[model samples]
Target: MCNTVKVSPRKLDPETRAALVDIAAKLLAEHGAEALSTRKIAAEAGTSTMAVYTHFGSMSGLVREMVHEGFARLERQFAKVRRTDDPVADMAVLGYAYRQNAKANSHLYAVMFGGQSLAGFSLTEEDRQYGRYTLLTVIDCATRCIEAGRFRQGDPRPIAHEMWIATHGVVNLELGGYLIDPANADRCYDGMLSSLLVGAGDEQRAVTASMAASKRRRRREVEVDPEPAEAVATRR
Candidate 1:
């Protein structure tokens, strides 16, 4: 799991390079992360297996790329939400977009933010920029809320961070199919957003709506997950 595998810098066109990674992501999404192999990815990308080595260094390098691209996808989605006079509404919409993107890209999301790195893959700081950028977008949205007098007057980073933490918990649980009712995604999701925004000065109405939905859900749930925290962390 290292990026130390070396080759000459690629001379392939950028499109071809992107194609390789794109094919790899699609394969991983469809077939699971363990399906990745230089030969298979190259075959799908219509390139020589050596291209993986030349362009990405190794399997681990490719995994790194997949992880980063997942966050890049998030950045692009959030970018599509236009700013508005109602920053609170804007933030709420962005939150919904975040969850939708997660649902749409579940497999990629699993690989990227999943609790563990792929075998033969290692993550470096550079691999984290896209994810970091997504966080920055959240902070930016929170900043807008504050400037619009929707949130408490203060640094938006912490506010953004709190929202992010809450968001991640729901996203992760949903990704694991731990939701009490899969069909109730919107309800739990809204609850989480409402819970986070309560601190931002939004009316508690969303909070009440979200909580009622949760209580209805918990009544039918059973405790089936027995995986230890460390195990979940290592292989999630």
Candidate 2:
């Protein structure tokens, strides 16, 4: 005869889980994926290694959740972009939102974009699509631009994709310290976005006007609700 005792999984504590995820993301951003270890995350989070397992099952699960968190943040930023009559302006705002999300969550951003890879973890095709799901908002804005004749009459996916590629290139460079000068980086980013809009069949003057409008809207948002102290400290 054999006797067996079964142990149930620990219930997740949302606050503790969130804290651990945040600590993991910060460590990843500051020290790279190589620094991600269950022991280290537990230590930095002031919890036990068992907490990590309790919340995420494994380190890979934590990494996967980090990727989801990155996209979730971007989605929130997109949701904050108020829709305006000018679809072109809205598209530009989406681009700005994308950049802001990446900057604000650089730790998760790096992992989300494959800047670093977790050991024994690989994103499946479904996981990749989940990430791309965030771009649907941009595509919707692009579609509106096309309907309004602001962009060429064609499928909007490619236009949205090109915008994403160009924006990603600029952001990636900025993150890599290639665009060190703030003024230069801003110029480069704005110029690149403007060029993409123009190439997408919008008039140069209209593109400039749309981008200006987007900037103003972003400024208003910041004025209305300033960045938090913690975020400011992190940015600094």
Highest-scoring model, lDDT: 2
Where does candidate 2 stray beyond 4 Å?
A: 1-13, 222-236
**Can you write out model 2's per-residue Cα lDDT over 169-217, one digit (the tens) per residue?**
8888888888768668767888888988999999999999999998888
Q: Report, for every candidate in turn, its global Cα lDDT versus the true structure.
A: 0.69, 0.79
Q: Extract clashing residue pairs from model 2.
A: none
| Stretches > 4 Å off in candidate 1 | 1-14, 29-33, 205-236
Model 1 scores what on Cα lDDT?
Answer: 0.69
When summed lDDT is taken over every stretch of 10 residues in candidate 1, the lowest stretch is 221-230
C-alpha root-mean-square deviation, candidate 1: 10.5
Number of clashes in model 1? 1
